[model samples]
Target: MAAETSDQYETLQIQYPPSHRRGPLPLPPVSRWALGSVLAVGTGGFLVLGAALAALVTLYVQGQAELREARTELLAAGAPLLPPNSPRSPGETPAAAQRRKDQLGRWLQGLALGWRYHQGSIYFFSSERKRWDDAQLACRASHAHLTSITSAEEQEYLARESRGGTYWIGLVATGPGGSWHWVDGSSYSSAQSFWAAGQPDNSDHGEWGRESCAQIHPVGNSLWNDHNCNFTFFWICKRDLSGP
Candidate 1:
């Protein structure tokens, strides 16, 4: 055994078995005349080519064994098996796409939108409430961002699931008078918003600062509101496929 090595970003743990000797398996002889004069067709070439073929066989067998062992280890640990590295193209089949999504669901486990994953992103709703900044920090701790509602369908789903609970969303005031931004770096200026009537007026209402952060709080059946950043509210976290 050896000590593990770590850096600021990651730590690696590797263990190697003791070394062993390996040699080419015994192979039947191949006549030099069968190959060609171009192979330097000498007696030595005959032996070398035979050994090379045997070595290739041995390497293939060894690689297959290693792959099986690794797959077994992953299964025993309840880990999701990785899919192929190729990107999905139009020619890809539905079965392959489903397998990819299933693998993602297994990896996502405790945090996803149940089975309704949204456009390669998962959602996590916090149980406790916090100020807007603190809520964002909490989501970041999980390698996620505060959720941003991008479409009417998504907003409907969130509102229905929220069940009257106030949640701090990712939108924050980026400019004066109704200008807002989502924290995930997506531009929402021209996008559809769910602002309630007369919302985001930057009212003080005796609070120290004006409303600056957005939430999924409903007023008169509307789903968006601007609240003071200091107010505590449970938050939703969105982790895209690119997130850790």
Candidate 2:
């Protein structure tokens, strides 16, 4: 019999040996609609996947930009030196406690940009120079005071971190009785003092005032030096983690 024709099929003839005579066999049907449907579904799925990936990337970039903007704004506003509040009181509302926690987090985030939280205190080592009095004022502005190293460990850490640079500490010579004193009301003798040999000799540099202010001289060793209060130098300030 002759081959039948159809809109859904394509046919091809297969050659065979003359001894095995037979009529042309019909080829399997190849539907245009099925092929188009498969291509369309595959393409749509790939397009959807690509769009999803693009959306994710866009969201990530937007989130990072917002985060950076928020951090910059927080730092510019300055950080508070006050410690986080104590655990919520029995009468305190949950909303109030949450607000306080969020505020504390903002403070910490701003402070982390320029201060190091260490051993119940946050210390700031400035790279800029200022006079002793000006440096003290700067510290006060930050709700801190020039470093009054209360322990040997603090002294050692300051010396190490401040190596290769001189910094004004809290020590001064004009106490109540013309004795050395720390700005935080601690006497120089109270701290684990490490004055350089022959320091505080009251050298005036042949100027108007005496060498009354103390600075960290970490060149040869972690020792202290007496310098004129008017002298400009880098400074170190520490804010207590506790409240009064």
User: Which residue pairs show backbone clashes in model 2?
Assistant: none
For residue 156, give model 2's deviation from the true position in Å.
Answer: 0.6
Candidate 1 deviant stretches above 4 angstroms = 1-106, 112-116, 175-178, 205-207
lDDT of model 2 at residue 145?
90
Per-candidate TM-scores read 0.53, 0.57
Residues 113-207, model 1: lDDT tens digits: 23224445567777887888888998887667899888888888888877787798999986656568899886685448888766666766253
In model 1, the clashing pairs are: none
Question: Which residue runs does candidate 2 get wrong by more than 4 Å?
Answer: 1-110, 175-177
Give the top-scoring candidate (TM-score): 2
Task: Report lDDT (CA) for all predictions.
Answer: 0.67, 0.69
